[model samples]
Each structure stands twice: as C-alpha cells, then as structure tokens.
Target: MAETSRGIGGLAFDASKRARPPELNVLIALIAIVAAFELLGRLLIGDSFLFNTRDNVDGIFNQQRLEIIILQVSIVGIIAIGVTQVIISGGIDLSSGSVVGATAMISMSFAQVALVNGQPNPKGVFLEQGWVDLPVIVPVLVGLACGLVAGLINGALVAYTKIPPFIATLGMMVTARGVARWWSKGQPISFPTESFAAIGKGLMPVVIFVTLAVLFMVILRYTRYGKYCYAIGSNEQAARISGINVEHHKILVYSIAGVLAAVAALVLSSKNLTAQAGMGVMYELDAIAMAVIGGTSLSGGRGSIVGTMLGALIFGVIISGFTFLRIDAYYQEMIKGVIIVAAVVLDVYRQRVRSRG
Candidate 1:
C-alpha cells in the first residue's frame, strides 16, 4: 500500500513539472498590454481614437480595421519569419528591408504593360510602351531570383570571407537600397499586370502570411534542419564538431531569408499596384522587434514559429490600439520603441532567473 502511494505521488510530481509551460510569463505580459490598451481607448480617448467606435467595444473585430492591420504587418511578418530562422541559427539579418525595396522595383519593371487605347496602363506609374505586356510569372521569377542572389551574397560574405554577420548584412543593406534607387532612377515604378496585382490584393497577404507561418512552424518543429538551427544557435563550435555542415546551413538559412523577403516585396507591390524604391524602408526593424517581442532570444538557440506568429499579432494589436486611442503617430512610434526595450530587458532577466534556479 505504501509503495502504491509513493508511485502515485511520483507520477503527480512528474506531471506537474512537465505541465509547466514555457513562455507563460511572456504570454501574461501580452495579455496585460492588450487589456491596458483596451481600457485606455474606452475611457480616455472616447470616440476620437481610430479604434474607439462606440458601436463595437473598440471594434477590435471591425472587419475593415482588422484587415488593414493585417495588411500593414503582413510584409514585415514575412520578413520576421525569416529573421527568426537566422537568429535561431546564431545570426542576424539587417538587409531584408532593403531587399524588399530592391525586389519591388526590379520585379515591377518586368510586370509593366504597354499603354493601350490612350488609357495608359493603370498598373504602372511609368508606362513604358516597350516593356509592357510581359507574362505575370516573369516579374515574380525575377524578384525571387534577385532575392536568391542577394541572399547568397550575404551568406558567402559571412561564411566564406570570414566577415561578421552584422557587417556582411549591413553592407548588403546599403547595396540593396542603392540598387532599388538605381533601378528606376529614384522614381516610383508603377504599373503591374492585373494578375500580378492580385497577389497582394484584399485578403491575399493574410493568406500568404498564414500559409507561410504554418509551413515554417512545421519545419522548425519537426525537421532535422530545425534541430540543427537550435544546436548551432546554442553553440556553433559544438554543433560543427558534431558533424553539422555549419557553413552550408548558414548559407541556406540566409538564402531562405532572402526568398521570404522577396515574397514580401511581391505582396507589397501587388497590393499597392506600384513599386517604390523606398517601399520597405525601416521594415527590418519591425521584423526584429516582432521576433524579440515574441520571446525569441537574441543570443540565439531558443525560439519558436508559434512565438513569432503571436508576436506579429501583438504588434498588429498594439498599432491598432494606439490608433484607436487617437495617439499621435509620432508618439506611437516612441511608445513602441519603449515597449521593445522593456520586453528585451524582461526576457534577459527571465533567462538569468532560470539559470540561477
């Protein structure tokens, strides 16, 4: 009888330990933020805020505002997904924003259609008579190819040339922005095929965001590649000694990041029906913030796609909340920065506590 009781107690203890959820603390913080914002919008701002409609409890469920928030963050969220992989592999990417700009310009150039019936091509801002009517696939392929090449360059510089990840990506960032401007002489490239525009129209960005998020979640959770990412991020030298092809994997990871950035550019251009050389300015910062806010460690090795998705949601909600409260746009930016810093500090403190415990 005593043996049976002991066994039951042991089982209970084991279950309790296992039941302790990871990142519960972060989740709590997120909930607090939402609740605080909701209250502020309802009481302080009244109807002046973007999200303070009296008809619907701040109208978080308002289809139009929800759609707008999703659209606004979808491109940055895509880049954040890639950045998650890079950080998990013990690296960083500062070039993704610039990649978006460059890819948009270059790809839209291929999508231009010739003017017809004196109506001019509405898809393009500069309707070049010679370059219009190209197949839809051409621009997409070109954008992806550009992304692949840029990613490869970034990977090579870091992996083969022994450059620091930050330096390599920084160089790429500048180069890509220059390429974006040079492609169209600093002018917005407008006019894309109707079919091409459909890629970023309406709910398509949300669709792509959801699909990619699911795919990456599976990849990071179940595959050997995922295992290696955690292993490398936790300890690169140890990972290499264990027979992981650290260099090749790094190259592949950054390249994948580039491809994802291109996907973002495609969606952005399609939705806007015009590609600007400055289309993705400052987007990389937002992506990084999303990843970090989701509780992904900057030190690498520990993160999840689920966390990233949640982080994106948090970001969207915060932006929406600010607008709902009628906060000035500039003030919103300042508050976001503060929140990011607070999150990071909290994360570091948590890590320390876990280690001590």
Candidate 2:
C-alpha cells in the first residue's frame, strides 16, 4: 500500500509538471484582441465590432462582417498552411508569393474562356484560342505542376546543393516573378471558364482553406512524415543518425509548400477573374506572419495547423478592426510590422522558458 501510494503520487506530480498546449495561449490572445476591438468600437464610434447594429439584420452577430473577415484572410491562410509545415521542418519559403504570381498567370491562361459574350476572349493569353477553355482540371493540373516543379527545384537546391533556404527561395522568388511578367508579357489574364471561376466564388475559399487545414493537422499529428519533420527540425544530426532521409524530407516539405502557394494563386485569380503580374506581392510576408503569430517557432521543431488557423483569424480580426476604426493603410502596415516583431520576440522568450524548464 505504501509503495502504490508513492507511485501514484509520483505520477500525479509528473502530470502537474507538464506544460499546457501552446494553442490555448494563442486562443486567449485572439479573444483578447476581439474584446479590445469591441470595446474600442463602442467607445469611439458608438458601434459594435462583431454585433449587428443595423436594423436590417435580424441576428445579433454581424454575419456579413464575419464573412468578409474570413474571406479576406482565406487565400493568404492557404499559403500559411504550407508555410507552417515548412517552418516546422526547419526551413523557410520566401518564394510562395512569387509562386502564386507565376502560377496565377500560367494557370489562368489555360482556364480562359474561349469566348466572352460571344466574342473571342479579349484578355486571352493565347491568340489561337486552342489553349483557351480547356477543362478546369487542365488549368488546375497545370498550376499544380508549375508549383510542383518550382518546389522540386527549391527542394533540390536546398537538399542537394546545400543552399540556404532563404537564398534559394529568394532566388526562386525573383525567377518566378519574372515568369509571371513574361508569361503574358506583363499583361493580365482574365475571363476564366465558369467551372474555374466557381472554385473561388462565395465562401468556397474558406471551405478550401478549412479543408486543407484539417487534413494537414491530421497528417502532421499522426503520420511518420510529421514525426520526421519534427525530428529533423529539432535536431538534424540526430534525425540523420536515426536513419531518416533528411534531404528527401526537406525537399518534400518545400514541395508541398509550393503546391499550397499555387493553390492560393488559383483561388485568388479565379475569384478576381484576372491574374496580374503583381498579384501576391508581399503575400509571403503575410503568410510568414500568420505562421509566426500562431505560435510556430521560427527556430523550427514546433507548430501546428490549428495554431495557424487561429493565427489567421487573429490577423483577419486585426485588419478588420483597423478598418472599422478607419485607420490609415500606412499606419496599419506599420502596426502589422510591430505585431510580427512582437510575436517573434514572444516565441524566443517561450523557447528560453522551455529550455530552462
């Protein structure tokens, strides 16, 4: 009886020592941000941040504002999903925004409707019209392939040649942007087929983002692939010694990131009905900020899909709140930069506390 009691006590003590999941902290931050906005709205404008004040609405919650917030963040959130994985695998992808630009141009060309209002597509990339109005799958596949190829190149460079991820992805960024410009000679590609356009219509982007987030969350938490990523990020030498294919896994991680970026491009272009050379400018930074704000350790070996989703929500809320307060765009940008830095600083502090513990 004495021995059993001691054992039980020890187990209880161990359990008590365990730290809470990081997502809880992020969730709290999100709630706090929302509350802050709500308070500010009431004090400053005699309005509500998330409640419907207009007489036209029957519900208390502002459904339109909620939808707008989610829709605005959904595309960039998709890119952040991939960025989360890459960062967890101990790498960065600076080329995702460029990949979006390039993929948008390339894929939209294939998805162009042969005729607009019974006339040839005025903004078509191909003059022959043969390349236009191909099946939706064709453009999707083409877009995915473009991303895959770019990702493969990024992976190969980092894994085989030992190029730093920053430099490699940066180079790819420039190259991919150039491709975006060159694809249509700096012209915009517009007028996609009905099927292609349907991909991003209404709440479709949110649906897609949520689907991918849930799927990858499962993959990262339960699969060997996820274990390898964590192991590699935690300690590359240890992972290599444990018989993991570090190079191959790194390549795979970056490749998936590229594909996700392409997915964002496809959705964005489809929704906007046009693909521009400058589409996705600074999106990489936004994706990275989302990941980092989600409690993803920039140092790697730590992060989650759930956290990223919550982070994206936080981002969306801040942006919406600012606009509600009528903040200037430049001031918003400056504040965003500060928030990003603060998140990174907090991450570093967390790492330190964990090490000490």
Candidate 3:
C-alpha cells in the first residue's frame, strides 16, 4: 500500500482524496432538500414554506416548524445514537424497537398511580392488584433493568453461541414484542406518577437526546471502548490477535444499546402519558435509517455520532416537509423506503472505494 494510504483502525482510508467529509456532505444534502421544499411551496401554494417575510413579522426560520422538526426526531434520535454504535461495531440490532415496547409496558405497570379522583383508581392496571403505586424511580429502574437484561441476552447469544447478529436480534425482536403484548394482556398502561410524566414533557425529549448525544460523542471519540469497537468492526481476527476481548466488548456494546433503547422508551411513554404494546413499531428501522443516512457505513468500522445527529435532523426535516406539502402518509413511507435503499447503495460504494484506495 502507498504511504498516502492507511487503514482506519483496520478498514482502508486514503489521505490523498479530497472528498468532503461525510457529515458535511449530509449537511449539504439537508440544505438542498429544505430548499427544494421551499421552492415547491412557492410554486404550489403561492406561499413561503420555511419563511414568512410577506408580513415581515414572523421569523425567517419558521420557528414553529423548526421546533417541530427537532422535536419530532428527538425520541427516535436517541435510539439512533445506540444504533449508530451497534452498526459501527459491525453488528446489527433489530430488537431495539421491540425492547422499547417491552420496557414501556413493564415500567409503566410499576409507575402507575394508585389513585384517581382521590379514590382507588379505576382503569388502574396495578392498583386493584397487590402492586400499589410505586415511586417514579422504581419504574425507571425497572425499565433500565428490562433493557439491560434484553441487551445482555443479545450479547450472550452473539458472543457465546456465535449466532449471526441478524438472526439473533430478529428472534429477540419477535420475543420482546410478544412480551410487550402479553405484559398487560394487550391493554395500554397509563396514568404514571407526576414525577414520571415530567421526564419527557414539552422540550424534555430534545434535551435528553442532545445530552445523550454529547455524552456518547465524547465517549466514542475519546474512550478505549470506541477504539475497541472500531477495531472489532474493522477486523475481528486481527482484534483478537491484538488482545482485544472481542466477546466481552461485544456484550458491552449490545448492553449499551439496550439501555439506550430503554431510555428512549421511558421518554416516549412519558411524553405520550401511556405505553402500548405497539408503541415502538418500525422504530428500529427508523433508527437504522438515521445512522445510514448520516454516513455510517453499514459494513461497519466507520461512523460518527455527529453524522448520525445530522442524519436525524435530515430525517425530521424531510418527514415534516412532506407533511407540510400535504403528501399522503403512504406516499411518505414509500419515499422513505427509497431513501433508505439509496443510502445503503451509497454505503456499499463507499466501502468499495475504501477497499480499492
């Protein structure tokens, strides 16, 4: 190999290339997309899509729409943070969405208030039973425990049993969703304590998402765990030869992913004031999509939390833009699918270039 070329931990990288950084590229694409929407808005509705200089009163950024875009993606962005790590380790996790479903149901069952109207609660899933209203911490702990256990199971299966990541997580996905459905016998869990409800009220989800992203960004960029993940994804055989306990590292990574999913569930349930068996349907895919669009290589070994954040922003903007344009729900889904496929194709191409470089 030429001196100008070196491996990224283990994957290939060419310093000679002048290509724009992945995150920057995605940012540009997001701007282009927003501009397209704005143009369409002007042509179709004879009104501004993102600005309102017509009155010279509203802010130029369409403050309400900006808030909507950020808030809409924050819950799922938390999940994407975890998913980004998993994919960076060259592993796939299909169980996260289901983990959210399961965690939500289990935690809410504990968090439910025993009283309504200053009386024994009716519609109380736990009040009529021996399980009375527990403190908010109890439910939060329960949720975290549920997520940790589920993640540990995934790690064990993949690390010890040597099962393929896809198959293992897929099995978990089905099982966890089943658990969610069975938790309250198909009933929705609601009426959480005031403390619990406050966890994700209003702008709280965005706060939690941003804080976690910053924390993990630091960890991923500055920690041994980050290096180990890149090493494993880049080349497992070489990582093992270099004294990395590949199995333990994998378990740790998966466990982290699980806990993050649980946190997302907590925030989501708190925001909605309820938890349902179907709460997180297709969420795993959305999280994965964010990672991919953010320039996380699907083949693994290369990604960034910043890129995923931008990807999430793009996701929020696109979805909200579609709604702003009055696009139908079904059509929106189709377009999203196309975008995901395109992202994967682009990733594959990037991998090929790196391999050749």
Candidate 4:
C-alpha cells in the first residue's frame, strides 16, 4: 500500500510538471493595455476624444463607440483569422490585402444593380448587364472563386516550385493590386443590389466574424487538418515523412485564407455600397500584426484562434483609445508601428525560452 501511494504521488508530480497551461500571458497584457488606455483617456484627454468622452461611468459604456470598434475590426479580424492559420503552418501571405482589394472590385462588378429599367445605367462601370438581379449567392460565389484561383496559384508556387513564401506572396501582392487597379481603371465601383448591400448591413460583419471564428475554433481543435498544420509547422520534413501530404495541405490552407479574404472583401464592399481599387491597402500588415500580437509565433508551429481574437480586440481598443485621446493620426500610425515591433520581439523571446526549456 505504501509503494502504490508513492507511485501515484510520483505520477501526479510528473504530470503536473509536464503540463503547461495555455498562454494566458497575452491576455493579461491585453487587459493591462486596455486598462492603461482607459485610464489615460479618463485622466488626459477627457471628453475631447472620439470614444473617450467623460460624461459619467455610464457614458463610458458608449454603445455607438463600442459598435464602431467592433465594426472597424470585424473585417480585418476575419482576414487575421486566415493569416493566423498560414502563420501557424510556417508560411506568410503578403497578397491577402491586395486579394481583398481585387476581390472587392471584381465581385462588385457582378453585384451591381441596374438604375435604369431599359437602358444601361450610365453611372455603372460595367456596360453589359450580365447578371443583373441575380441572387446574392452569385457575387459571393464569384468572390470565393477569385480567391480560390489566387490561393491555388500562391500555394503551387510555394509548395511545388519551391519559391520562398515571402517572394511568392510578394509577387502575388503586386499582381493582385495591379489587377484591382486595372479592373476598374482606378474608378470606384458602386450601386450594389440592395440584397448584396444587406449582407454587410448593420452588425452583419460582426455576426459573420463570430460565426466563422466559432467554426474555425472547432475545426482547429478537433480536425486532422489542424493537427497536420502544427506538425508541418513544427517540422515540415518530418510531416512529409509521416505521409501527411504536405503540399496538398499547404494548398488547402492558402485556399482557406483566400476564401476568408474574399469574404472580408464582400462584406466591406457591401457595407460601403462601393468598391475602390485601393480598398484593402495595408490590411495584410494589420492582419499579420494582429496574429503576432495575439502571441502567434512567426517562427510557426504554435498559436490559437482565441489569441488572435483577443489580439484583434486589443488592436481595436488601442486604435479607439488613441482616437479617444485626441492623438494625431500620424502619431497613431507611429504608435502602431512601435507596438508591432514590440510584439515581434516578445514573440522571439518566448520562442527562445520555449526552445531552451
């Protein structure tokens, strides 16, 4: 009986030592940042800032400001979700931002409604009324299809041609931006069908973002594909040797990323009732920053969607906080750059420590 009790105690000790809790450190940092911003808003800028008015504690709970933050971040958050997956698979995608722009422009062309019943709408960019009054599904499908093709090309270049992810995605980035500009000749496309506009109306982006997030969380937690992402990210050669079809998986991951970017594009264009060729400029960097800030390692093999979500929230809060503080827009950009660098440095430090342990 003594021996058995000793063995049990030893086993329990070993288990405790081996188990590492989920990285709550990022969450703590995020909370601290928010609190700090809130305090600063209250003490420094007072009521002059955008979201930082000090009528009372109740006024601090501004629904409009909260909704604006969520709305602003929702589309970027969706793209960040996809970017997180790619980063976890030890890859980077610079083209996603341009992809959003290109997809938005092209899909809007298909989603345009006719202003004149008989004659072509002079205000419309596309002369031919091919799919006028088509179901909302048409534009959505068009956007997804564009994304699928782009993702396939990106994946092929990286996985089969042995192109570096950076170079391949950079090339795609330029190409996608050029496509967006050339498609509409630098003109903004407008007049989407009411149904199409409805897709992004109200809190729809938030709803879609939340729903997709939940679905992806389940998939990443329970699916074989998610397991393989970690395996490849941790060690690609080993994953290949394990017969995991690394190439196919890479394609799938990139495709999913593309699809998500396309969805973001659709929502953005629909909400604005117009699609500009430059709509998604710099969004890729923001998405990557969100992933990195959320504790996703750029070195790969370790991350969580929850972390990405929190990171998005942190980003929204910071931006809103800055506006609340009545800071100059240029200063906000500077602050964002500094924050991103800090996040990357912290990620590297954590990686080194984990490796040593």
Using TM-score as the measure, which candidate wins? 2
Best by lDDT: 2
Candidate 2 CA-lDDT value: 0.93
Task: Give the runs in model 1 whose Cα sits over 4 Å from its true position.
Answer: 1-23, 47-60, 116-129
RMSD of each: 4.0, 2.2, 3.5, 3.3
Each model's TM-score, in the order given? 0.88, 0.96, 0.93, 0.91
Ranking, TM-score, top scorer first: 2, 3, 4, 1
Error of 2 at 32 (Å): 0.1
lDDT by residue for model 4 (1-357), tens: 646545564643344544353348778887798678777866785543334354554554666777877778999999998998999999999999999999999999888887767666554765564567668988999999988888888888889998889899999999999999999789898888889999899999999998888888888879998998888888999999999999999999998998999999999999999999998999999999989998888988988788888888888888887787778889989999999999999888867776686
Error of 2 at 151 (Å): 0.8
How well is each residue in 246-323 modelled by candidate 1, as lDDT tens digits? 999989899989999999999999999889999899888889888888878888998887787778877887888788
Task: Estimate candidate 3's alpha-carbon lDDT, on a 0 to 1 scale.
Answer: 0.90
lDDT of 3 by residue, 23-113 (tens): 9889898999999999998888766668754565666677778888999999899999998999999899999999999999999888888
Local accuracy by lDDT, each model: 0.84, 0.93, 0.90, 0.86
Between candidates 1 and 4, name the one with more favorable lDDT.
Answer: 4
- Between candidates 3 and 4, the one scoring higher on lDDT is 3
- lDDT: worst 10-residue window of model 4: 12-21
